[model samples]
Target chain A: MAALNIKKGSSSHSAYDLRDFHSQAERSHTLALIVDNEAGVLARVIGLFSGRGYNIDSLTVAETDHKGHRSRITIVTRGTEAVIEQIKAQLGRIVPVHEVHDLTVESAAVERELALFKVVGGGDKRVEALRLADIFRANVVDSTLESFVFEITGTSEKIDAFAELMRPLGLADVARTGVAALSRGA
Target chain B: MSRTMTGAKMVVQALKDQGVEVVFGYPGGAVLPIYDEIFQQNDIRHVLVRHEQAAVHMAEGYARSTGKPGVVLVTSGPGATNAVTGMVDALMDSIPIVVFTGQVPTFMIGTDGFQEADTVGITRPCTKHNWLAKDTDRLAGIIHEAFHVATSGRPGPVLIDIPKDVQFATGTYTEPRQARVDHYKPRLKGDIEAITRLVELMESAERPIFYTGGGVINSGPGASQLLRELVDATGFPITSTLMGLGAYPASGKSWLGMLGMHGLYEANLAMHGCDLMIAIGARFDDRITGRVSDFSPDSTKAQIDIDASSINKIVHVDLPILGDVGHVLEDLLMIWKSRGRKTNRAALAGWWKQIDAWKEVKCLSYAPSETVIKPQYALERLEALTKGRDRYVTTEVGQHQMWAAQFLGFEAPNRWMTSGGLGTMGYGFPASIGVQIAHPESLVINIAGEASFLMNMQEIGTAMQFRAPVKQFILNNERLGMVRQWQDLLHGGRYSQSWSESLPDFVKLAEAFGAKGIQCSDPAQLDDAIMEMIEYDGPVIFDCLVEKHENCFPMIPSGKPHNEMLLAADAEAFKSGAALV
Candidate 1:
């Protein structure tokens, strides 16, 4: 939660400053949810965000339990502290949701995303693309006479940095999976 | 050994086991099997409504009036779509209701067969929980679970989309006790330490106030009695939200009246000035909070609710106790009594004195009219005539609803019903009928505005057929009064399409439906007209023509704080949009 900085002489109730109530500093939070692995469960989770006007930057979900019938969804969203708290509470209200863990606040969590970059060029640009991939420890998954497909796995920020560098080296297209996060401790 | 039965029979049996005595529903092609099952059973009486929306509203009335879950059975596609508004209303107001929609056969569900609809998909966000019954073996258990989910925690509407094929298929019947409902269990009792802390706050607080809401009513009659006891022990002033009006007696000495937008002057002022605000069972809705930035900026706030999510969702509180309102109040009282029950009584006397001065302002006062009746005056007369009777009142949204909340004095809980959260216009009449059906000997009235009443005027026929003598007291102003009033104050009197043009003659409309009708326009004839409508043995639509230009006042206009109320006397003071801003 962010601190409320009280500005002097601006409010009648000097003890409590509320002028910036709605303008609290926005920060991104990663929430990991365990839910029933039933039909329309994902839609229910996503609909809550869209319906309540909460912003979802990225979402990834997959069935984690085969016998028990449960799925894990990791969602990265941005909101003020109050709004984030409300989002988590609202998500918990949905009947099928078993648990909601705010990995960002709960503890230091590992965040990873997988991305693929396809660079197509004839000579110098193609060599530069391969050189950058090699330097970043990205594997060249495919290659042709004019193009190379580089696969990389890292944090979202690292992936963004890789894509930014790949643009000058004739990056033709890019595809990235959303973030999947987990808490550090048991 | 469990006996097998058709899913339709199981649906009816499941409802009976849940102690559902009545169901408000409408029938169509896909629901025929269930309708046939309903027809063969006398244990569950079904009141057929003209529209699916009305069915849901009636169920809301039934649920809210009695502390039991209302049941509804509607066909798929159009039927399910039409019931969306009422479901949303129930969800917002925290009314417990289980809606069963008859879907197309499981095989032809997505193929868009006749009367097919994605009831589960469409209603998922609006309902507390929803399911599409793919197997007959799970139908009874799902129905039982639907009732459980709707009635537990923060009570809300739930839905089950049962396919026609499943209704026809045979499955083993599951008893209510056999249903696996342990997956979702709501906490019923508050933490003992937190309850003790609240008791301590009550012990030392001078300017303490109890802000209660619908959760008290939903917790059942025991909660309301416990609340009265708690208030008595603490000697704290109490105010309630619109949905929570009758939870505490309006005639009580410490009652501050209903608080919020359109709330009494003293109540809102007390809320704004209180040193300690203890919110019980009520979510601090925006309508009650006014400008959140300025809402009770000085008070040390504490909230007690069954839903943990409602605790800090809006205005943050210093104390948050999560549990059922009844259970918490009982524990709180027990702790306070055991701790020798102390309070700053001398300070509370001063607080009451200050409140009396605010009450002298009479925020509900309106200018007397000799020719045309005033809406507030009509409600006052209605209250005067029916104050001591076994009365149940429901109201359509807008000016008339606010006036009813102001004028009528309720001494008990579950006696007043309205669309407080959704503010649906067509809610009252159907709800009144539902109440009348549940309590046949009681006097049930629907306080309505003409425009709003006309939204579901077809329910009059349902009333006639069912012999549920509900009084339709329409304060006819020949205008969308609330809308017209807002336009006058905020839009420079640009009336737009706020007029109720070319309305039907209400007396004749009632006559057409084979029910009694009465019309009164003059202020002198109001009491007699209301008496006539009340004394009548059947349904009566009393069209009381009121002053067309009157506005609901003591209004905390959208962005203003509780202190900046626009009273009736100040109606002329703020005329333009700039003044409103």
Candidate 2:
């Protein structure tokens, strides 16, 4: 029973619809994509995600070559074996996606995102905001005119903690590029 | 080229150009500004339905009766929610309707503000397509697309959820959207080899029949003419489902009448005994087919429809032709013409003789006495009054509807408008009004029973408002005639208020609703009353009293064989088939 291969070829259909089944064992997968990082690029990708009702946990991107070149986007989403096949098939069909694969199948990749936050202060309120930012090891990029722009970089959780601390004193706004990840344990 | 005034005004103008003479709507918090703009604009009248549900139904009636798209408007939140049922009804029946609902102000959206609903998301399943117009300039184009989607192919409702802010914000709204289709490319060409096979089969078969359906009418007059040519050439026995009533003029030679639980006995028997059954644009619905395994067991079937999905989805076909019924029938006609296989009168007369005996003893089992008027007697009178003229008869659901479908022979298409699919209770009155408006010169009548007459008595005013000379025949039996008959047969007369406790005088009710009324309690009075009502310049209501619990004769109860039916007289001798008592 355990040897039953319920993969892509298990059924005659090109895809299967059994994502609702729950399992205890956790599995992880990753993929890197090259895309024209222009206006609405994010929206198109989000559309692909939402249309099939897939959930994405982490996403990170950058124009790595910087010759006004293409962008490298790393996306981390979870699914069962059948869902993974569909994701690969659907992602391959997208207009701008150069290629897609389950990196977990090939066994290699890396991913990350940077976040910045701003909070206002200049009195006792300012002192409290500074103290909270310091404990989280967030570097103070600039401080003046009753405000401070704190730069925080790390895993998403570390940035989250720093942002929470700044919130109590005078958190004004947050800018998150979300999480970007690559294949790990190469 | 010159840039025109902003998009919002163009939207209203486009609606006027599209011949959208009326819109049913109610103003709300978000749509007030657009309402103000529309109020200032020229053309396109608007009516304030008390509720959004009424707006959709009215649109449905307008679309169904006129074969044109119905347009509706409503403001957002609960207003849009109210329209869901009407949209779904239109969806089920494949009626064309364009719905415009206001959304919350763009900035105020996603907040828990007043009158905000995710209308686009909610209506996606019910509508063929929906648009959320982000700017006023695009509103005209969006409305144009909505109309196209609503009317094209197998028509269904399309909704446009307009944000209040978008309507208020100015943008260029112009562009005539040509009719564009994505998925529905129906095959018009028939499979020649398969059609040839059906022809060969039809030629060889001794007892052949044609079972036409509502799809023939939906395919338009071309479909009806092509089918009639085939029938006339072959001289085949013919029958129709309830929806297919007017496809074959009921008074024609080949017309074997309706085949169902409440269908003609001769037609039902021919379905069982026939060699080749040309199932044209008809599905084997449960009501018509009786039991699944026994449905036309001896017949070799040839089926065709515009929707490929419907083909082979129901009963199996020995020779299946998947394409538009109109084109296929034309191709079939050409094949026969090429072969020069004209009518064989001798074989046809023999079959007709057999059918005549069945019709005499097994069918047409309505008993008529001097004092007691039968439902079939009223239908016969209605038929005689029309005298085989082109007439539009819309009816409410019941025993009377069955009798009308049986006795009232129809010769025209779209001339008989009944709620065949949805069977909405109040459909008859408004639909009759809509038909009268479309065919102003033609005699239009709502052939409804007392129970159904009360359902939408208000729509009598719609006829009165337009000064339409529509005759409403309220078949008063003092009981829900069809239900009571079923209770008599099935429940041993454990009738649960099938008879009205205290029935209101519908003649007085018609007067209250601003329509002229005539009361006829006797068959002798029927002719004069009908003549006076027909000659009247305005809408008239005829409340005729008839005997209660008059069963639609040759009735096949559910789950029974179609041929095993009860005659009007001889209740116990249904199987042997009895003549009228």
Candidate 3:
């Protein structure tokens, strides 16, 4: 039935694509990079994105191989598929970057982020905050007479839900370490 | 196996080891030590310029003309800052140049010391790569690496900032052979499966066109030769970008001239009407692909480039072969021949018939003026006079540059140099000087507009000192013709700040600089004036006054597609926006 709709044309190129090229949906992608642990390498990577008008939702970097002087940077960015591909290619062109792997498509990756939420309240709001924190498996890292600081580690979505629950319960301040991701299996 | 020497001496030594014969630079306070080393050395020659910017431009001209990496040395602060424009210009055009800056003492780097600037930080985005040598022991190794990075894979400018203290300190001198450059090896040869697939596509491409660019020249003369051979073997039409003009001879049977915004009528029409588009060593820059979504909508595209990032960056291609242009063409040619060199000859003949009909438009034609020289007429005369000589041409950016690209016929690679990517004004005069310096006997010319000629007219002094017999052929249109043309067409003729008023008598200025100058406005006297300029043994500036309102035609308006080009006949109608109706 699908073959009946096929139309012959002068051009040999086909419009059928695995991913629709015409669709302009913005998507989130997590990319892992291995780069030389040298001075100004981070600046070069960040500058490329900023210079080219690409957006970074979250970014985290640390030296993974101390002996070899190699650092791993995990970046979560949002763009259309074509823009994402360009971002990855541009990242790979940086001199110190050795590898850029899009973990979003390469594997069923595990993503985690650590965040701290400080809730300041004096009455029912304080109790409600504690109850929600206990349900989400968040530990009270610091406490006072009227305030409590909860530390939570989870996927970005889970943490977002937890933060939403705390917002109505007198969420005062929040700090998040950007996402870090790794592949699931060998 | 290594000898210890001051870092300044190592800087000079590393340049020699890298086979750099000339250094275009200006001496400064922070660079006195290195200048002293340059003074002590006889193996290398340094050409001093009046300003730091001209030095870099001169080096770019030398590099582009000779196929060797140009070298530059300057001081920190203002010196490094002045060089930023040329560095970015070279970066945009993929010209291989190594710029070295002398910095303040290490301890005073960030303390607002005299003549201090964060050279690495300011040039990070513009340069291919850069380094600030903090250790004297690593200076030579880093210098060698800078040269390697500048010339390798998709050649571009690179910089290294050497502190004054580091230059004074002693270090182990490392030979270029001893430098560790193992990490940065770009892929040179294409994958066999992809090459075979491309050959299959080539065999069946009825309306195929080869769109080549500057990468062919950067890959060396052999790549250009291979390109010509491939074009001949396949019997396909070829067109080039502005930077790739000389890669294929304009006189070739299959040549369609240059294609882009200001391209020939038939070449652009062929691009729009082609079934297969084979891009060799060319990026699909927005200037080449106006309205990208509608650009060659039906073509099966294939791109061959050294930089992997350039593939699928703009227009996605069906086949992306990541390799050097030379190697890929060599493989493509061999496999194509092994398969009996098949082609869709019947369909190609039809395509040629269409192209020939379009060529009948004669888009480059203009009415020859008797009073004032038309810019096009001037360039055509210049071309007729210097067609077959050992001539090198550079141009300042404007309508005159496009006219030169249209009228000048380049027979071989490396004979044409212009600021294609950056569209820089004031590039041609010093560039012509550098080319003259390198090839002392070649007939070098800087095609200029009157407005752009004044931007770097100071280079005449440099030419006087060096005795470089470069010719400056200025089309004195008395206006910024391109800006005024755009204003007339797109902005309702409110020509603001486009007039070249209060301009100097260029002939008097040239004579004042101890060089010969000739001024001519009559169409009949153009050939004689050009002859006088060419025959002079010293630098000559020919200010040829031209028609003020003349515009370059066959233009695809900024947002329009290739098929909607405005030819010379449609210029007036299009300007009135009647063509849209």
Candidate 4:
């Protein structure tokens, strides 16, 4: 019975420093992991992070690229040096997980997280939020209450750009899953 | 993995593994399948609350009563929306709760189907994490992840919206997988350099003080016992905020009394004069710090907590130890152990001498007249009676609430349940009902002021329906005590109709609800009233008509500290000696 492939150690060293993780909003990283499709696997992964007081900025899971027998997970988190290593090691321990890597950790990787941003504005600002949404290739899901909910998917940086544009235009709230990624080409 | 299981079955099994005993919920269209499977099961006890909101609050009460996370379940649209208030309440207080709401079929998700609303979308801002499960295979994992998110990282509420189609779908699911969080880590390890420095400072400071908060207990009980050690060693006087009520047993030496709006004057003064303030797990909330700029300005503050954001968020810290309180205290204790240390009581002797004099003067002044009953006297008896006996006591929101919290010297964590952060007015009855349900074997009491008693007086019938042996003690002053007290203190007693209209016989109301009721007036009648409640098989009420114009003293008068209290309940210097002009 190959229950766990990733093993925590007698001296399990974590990836990042515990302090100043959340405080670094700009430097904070969100990584989405892609893994083999299996049950109870996600729980094992989340339990590892939460059992300790590690925070997840955003998380989303879905079955993408079914031909490869895989699923995509977008996770937003913050940490430093030793903390990042611990996260990868723990994910690899799950039975159904084939690999675990932070899409934002290395230069070769590309990361993307989806956000449905809701903004409330009137007059000129409403026109501005709409024009910016068009430029970002976002779809409007709902409107009224002097607001619009725009559904957009791209790299977290792109989403941030869109949100930043909407900020002056009346960005009320944003709901996003940190990031999800897959290697380019076969 | 098993082939015979459906997704809903696997979820039920997973909740059992997570050690969930009580589940508060209401059933609706989308969640019928889960309820069907639940009906056939025997392990988890399901409570049917009157509304979806009540289910969430009941879960919150259960969580507060027990030190574990509480679970609430509801169905699509309105049912899920009904939980919004409870969810926000839990979020504000940093309580651990997992809310499960049923959703419409996956095929009908976006086509405006029956009872369909984006449960996950609605809850995104308020929850720590949320899930929209279309695939049944991930059901167990989602539940597990929801629990992990809610209980971990500053503790909060999480929501999982399960579509009906997914629940009925077949899937081979095992247990939830535990994943590691690479970032947003908790500081279990303290800075050795900072900790030792504070310990050395504690050893020498002439007027050092120890102030603690709810964070101490959150760090765990073993950590709290260290308070006795530090105080015994340094002889520093101990004071606390409203939320830090039970960090220590009330009747101990070196205890300066509570500090804040309703705190003892000496404790507030001592806080100001102390050269060093050792604060663990407490934020300098405006209620505690008063006019922040003036609060203990001369003292060097040492702040410790698990949340890093809280480090410099409140009062500026000279020494900020960002880590779990339990871990930090244990490390300090280890360092203290190697020093061959013994408690030094010299620093406390003079302070205790001053406090003792203050206590005597207070007792002489506030002594109840032959005719009127003192509200504090009732609480004093309550404190004496419940000693060592484990009980759950909740209070309606008002002056009596503060009085109970101030006087109790609570011996355990979670023993006192009231809306501390939210301060909900009508939370008492329902909260008491929830507590009683959680601890069926333990006696539950709801201490209510005259006005706070009316917030959910309707629940007396609910208590009767369960034949729940819960007691309600009404401190009847015929007015909203706290509001009137504020008006008296700050508004020149303009008394803006905060007082109640002519009273109803609460005894009759209790009788109407099929429960026993008693009226109490004398201190001697206290034991008999409480005993009569113990004898009753169901809900009971104790009405003690107290003095109409009484005030809670040893007052810290809003922004003052340590020695600046009104000094006693009836300090003559605070009064104008001449008769009304």
Candidate 5:
């Protein structure tokens, strides 16, 4: 797992500097949402984000409990601290949403994303791709005369790094599953 | 004991169980079944409005004045779209209203059937909550829940879109008590620690001010009473937002007057200078807090509101007490009394002295003319005549609306209803009709500009038919006064499309609707015309012509700090096309 090094600071000065200066910069956060598995619930959540002009970088959802009839929706979004807090508060207010936990704020959470990269080349480029894949612990899921598909699952940052390293080595195409996150505890 | 009944019957039954006494509506093709059910019922009195938009405003007026959830019923498509403005207005002001919009049959909904609309989708952002009931079994419960959601925490408008087939289909009815709505439970009690911190700050502060808003009115009558008690006990100067007028009596000794853009000069100054600012039931709207960074630069602000999300959303506060206004005020009062009602009285006297100096400016004063009536003078005369009586005032958005806020004194909560948040132009006439319905014997007046009055002028038919006797006092400036003012000041006086051209003779128009009409231009005839309108047994439209270019002032230009407010005195030098100071 790796993290992106993004520039961080307040872009403009404010007279009433009531907020902590360090938290004013935009940062990515993964939020775990617990909601009722009901019709229109997902649309309502999506509507709120789109209507308000808030950005959602990644999202994934599925039913988590069969008996309880509850679903978990994991979303990765980037915003300032205040904006993130506002998003959490707003999500909690939706009638069908049972809970909203921001993994960045909770500080004890795991995040992972799966990616499959298809690399096509002849001699040296193909050999280097195989070597890097072994070092990154990625499996070669598919092989053809001209291409080898390497499957990798890890944090979003790690996937980004692997994809960046493979780009120059005949990386023909790539497919990624959006980040899915959960809080780690008993 | 549940019995199977048509969905339309269930809606009426649910409204009855919810204690709804009046419903403002306009019927259409898709709502025939609901209208039939309404006709068969005697418990719920339905007032047929002239337009769907007016129906929603009427409901808003009824809700704001009566402290109860206003109810509206409108048919599909255009009807739902027309009601959008009023719903947004109610949402902005935190007025509770439950609107039931008819939709096309289930199968015909997505196919663009006659009068069909995506009502739930359009209204989702504006309403506190909304639903499209596809199943008749869930229709009754949804109706009950709509009432609950609209009238509950930080009360606002909600919508329930009922398909025609659902109205015809038979479903098992659920009583209000039997409905399953356990998900929502808002915090009603204030945090004791935060309250204590606020009390300590209040007692020790030399310069403190209480800035209140519409939350007190929405928290019910008890909240206003508690607020008055708190203000009296503390002996601190108090000012309120436009929506919060009448929460504390305008005549109260401690009242500094309404604060914000177009607010009293003293109040704005107090807000800028106060060391401890206690914002009760008020979200610091941008209009109130000009230049967010520069707003109350020296104050240690504390806020108490029912909505937690409102806290720190814009202006951060030192203490945020999230709770219902009434409960929070009650707790604060108890703690203050238990601690011997401590306050820095000697320091407060000095603060009042400074406020007195600011009040001496007489920011509301204007040069009066004998031939042409001044808009402010008309409201003053209206106030003089209607004072000490059961009177409720509603206002359309613009210069006249601001003048009404400046001149009319409110002695109690719920007596003044205006479109504060969304600032919808045609709100007051229909709202006045609704208020008149609520208090049949009370004097109901909609202070409107000529252009604004024309937007919902058709509602005169509703007033005439219902015998509402709502007074329409049109300050006939013959212009969109506020827009013209902005053009005159900010837009280099370009004045594009601000004139109210080819307007009908309001007096003749009123007569056509079988209502009394009076036209007055002379200042001398103003009193008589106002009295005549008040004395009329039915609806009266009084068109009082005023000075053409009178701009509402003591104005704070948008994005300027509070201390930099431009007063009426400053307007005299700038009248000759010179730049505003």
Candidate 6:
């Protein structure tokens, strides 16, 4: 009930209001969802977003509580403040969704992505790649004379930077697990 | 111990337990078992429709008229796909309808077997909720759940796709009370603190308006009664969305007519200028709030809706009470009365004076001709003749629909049914039949345009077969009147495909279906012709020829704000390059 208190002239106004309408720019937010792990539940969630034309930049879902029959879905989507609020409101209306928490809005939340970089080269390029991997804390999960597959785990931004640095040197292939997010709390 | 029965028998048993008296449906390959069960049972009457689409529309009409979840049964594939439009229409309007669609046998599904369809997949987005029963044991439970989902909180259409094998296989019949559907619970009561804030706002505002929608009707008859009581107690000027008509008695002193795109001039002006706007059960759709940024700019708005997503979906409100309309209105009345029923009468009087000035514009005025009957004049005559009878009016989409909304005055909820949300073209004919079936002795009329009526004209056969006695009052303008009007205004009058050329002789068409047909063109004979259509004991089709070029005015053109309305008097000015802004 306390959260229901109306904020006087809150910065987040309805999209219909002309005063602060254009002031808010669109930004990406990651949301963690706990829902019933049942048939068509995932489809219903996906249908809601797709049917409404809302963009989903990244999405990862897995069964989190097998005993409780609950699955966790992490979705990264971009929208204006008003649009994001509407998305959350709509998601909450879906019957199977037990909880929806925006990790982006949470004070202490961690967002990490695992990526495998297959760098294929020899001599100077291989040595340089190995030295860069050492600095980035990327372990060589798979190694061959011609190719070295580096297993890296970090924030998406860090992984993007590492990939960008490895591109010119010897980056052959890239596989990434889209952002898996959770809040930092007991 | 639960009794064992085939799934087909369970479907019928479940429907009987749900208190369904009649079902509108069509037969197909996958549904033969259910149809056979229906044939054996005397408890539920099944009305076979000519097409699957009309069956859904009829169910919608039945639902709207009786305030019950209308039941529909159609087969797999094309039958299910054909029902998509009507389901979407019901979804948009919040009409409670439970559609049972037959699917291919469990093993044949996804193999593209005969009459196979992904009905659940296709309709997932259109329905409020849907289920695909893969097992026979779940069929009875799913049907019960479908009824629950369709009739609860914010009522809407729900579908249960039962495969042929499931229908044929034996299952334990689960009674309605035994069904365990604990996941989908919608909130029915309003927040007490929010109600307090709303009462505070209502008492303090100078120019207050109650802007209600179809939610008031969908909530129940008691909700409409409470709305009337609230309006009477506060002495506030009230307006409504197109779908919200009949929720408040039109003859009531506080009524300001329907407000929106084609709403009255005074109503739109009042909406734009009001200080306090109370939106009950009405979503702020694009049509209602034209140019959202400029919508109700000065109002401190409060919205009472059963659906949480509807609050702040289009226009943000100062107070958002998420609850059923009846529940919220009951609390509102109690709180207001406890507060000594306080209202600022002086300010309300001043507000009424301003509204009277706007009313002087006579936004609905049209040139009445003695030769060809004006569409508005025809509706006025129809309204005059059918005023006091037990009448239910359904309408097709077009200029005729707007004219009916303007000319007809509804005194009660559920008496006026139309395609408001999706604006389905051919909804009225089958809907009229459905209403007639629900209320056999009542005078049911489908006020239709020449073009929209043709969309589902084949339903004339269904009416004839059932002896529905539903009247089809067509305003034969020989054009898609609304589209033609838009072309005249916005598209430089190119007149593309709006004309209804090569149309059949409706009189002959009526006779071919074994129904009476009356065509009235002369203005002098209009009233008598309408009376003849009314007086006829059997189904009648009255094709009343009207002025083709007449436009539905007092229109807020798409994307324009409510205040920037185009009045009928200003038609010439707009055509002659006057400043529309």
Q: Please identify model 3 stretches exceeding 4 Å from their true place.
A: A1-21, B578-581
- Each candidate: chain B TM-score: 0.99, 0.88, 0.99, 0.88, 0.98, 0.99
lDDT of 5 by residue, A148-181 (tens): 9999999988999999999999999999988888
Q: Which docking band does candidate 3 fall into?
A: acceptable
Q: Locate the minimum summed-lDDT window of 10 residues in model 1 chain B.
A: B572-581
Residue B38 in candidate 2 has what lDDT? 81
What digit string (tens of lDDT, one per residue) describes model 3 on residues B1-581?
98999999999989989999989899888888999999997999888888888888999999999999999999999999999989999998999999999999999989999888899999999899999999999999998888888888899999999999999999899888889687677778887677788888889888999999999999999999999999998989999999999999999999999999999999998999898899998999888998898899889888898887787778887777778999999999999999999999999999999999999999899988788889999999999999889999999999999999999999999999999998889888888988988999999999999988888888888999888999999998889999998887787788999999899988899999999989999999989989899999999999998999988887989989999998878877887784244
For B1-581, candidate 5 gives per-residue lDDT tens digits of 77899999888989998999999999998888999999996999999998988999999999999999999999999999999988999988999999999999999988988888789888888888888999999999989888888887889899999999999999999888887677766778987877877888888999999999999989989999999999988999999999999999999999999999999999999999999999999989988998888999988888998886677778877677778999999999999889989999999999999999999999998988888898999989999999998899999999999999999999999999999988999999999999999999999999999999999999999999999999999999999999999888777788999999999999899999999889999999888988899988999999999999898988988898899888877764554534544
Task: Single out the weakest 10-residue window by summed lDDT for candidate 6 chain A.
Answer: A9-18
**TM-score of structure candidate 6:** 0.96
The reply for model 6, stretches above 4 Å from the true place, is A1-4, A7-23, B578-581
Residue A140 lDDT, candidate 6, scale 0-100: 97
lDDT of 2 at A123: 84
TM-scores of the candidates are: 0.95, 0.71, 0.96, 0.72, 0.95, 0.96
Error of 3 at B286 (Å): 1.9
Better of 1 and 4 by lDDT: 1
DockQ ranking from best candidate downward: 6, 1, 3, 5, 4, 2
Q: What does each candidate score in C-alpha RMSD? A: 4.4, 12.1, 3.8, 11.0, 4.7, 2.8
Q: Interface RMSD, candidate 1?
A: 10.7
How does model 5 score on DockQ?
A: 0.22
Model 3, residue B518: what's the lDDT? Answer: 96
DockQ for every prediction shown:
0.30, 0.03, 0.28, 0.04, 0.22, 0.34
lDDT of 1 by residue, B1-581 (tens): 79799999999999999999998999988888999999898999999899999999999998888888889999999999999999999999999999999999888978979888788888998799999999999999999888899999899999999989999999999888999798788778887876787787888887999999999999999999999988977889999999999899999878989999999999999999998999998898999999998998888887888887787778887766778999999999999999998888899899889999999998888898888898888988899999999999999999899999999999999999999999999999999998888899999999999999999999988999999999999999999988998898888889999999999999999999999989999899888888999899999999999999999989998888999989988888788545656
Query: lDDT (0-100) at residue B346 of candidate 6?
Result: 90
lDDT tens string, model 4, A1-186?
A: 111222222111222123332232344555556666654456655776786557787777888878976886766677753354446544543434554555554425566678999899899899888988898999999999699999999987899899888888888899987667664545
TM-score of 5: 0.95
Question: lDDT of candidate 1?
Answer: 0.89
lDDT, candidate 2, A77-140, per-residue tens: 8776545555665554333445454565544544445777889867897888777778777778
Model with the higher DockQ, candidate 2 or 3 = 3
Tens-digit lDDT string for candidate 6 (B400-473):
99999999999999999999999999999999999999999999999998888899998988998898999999
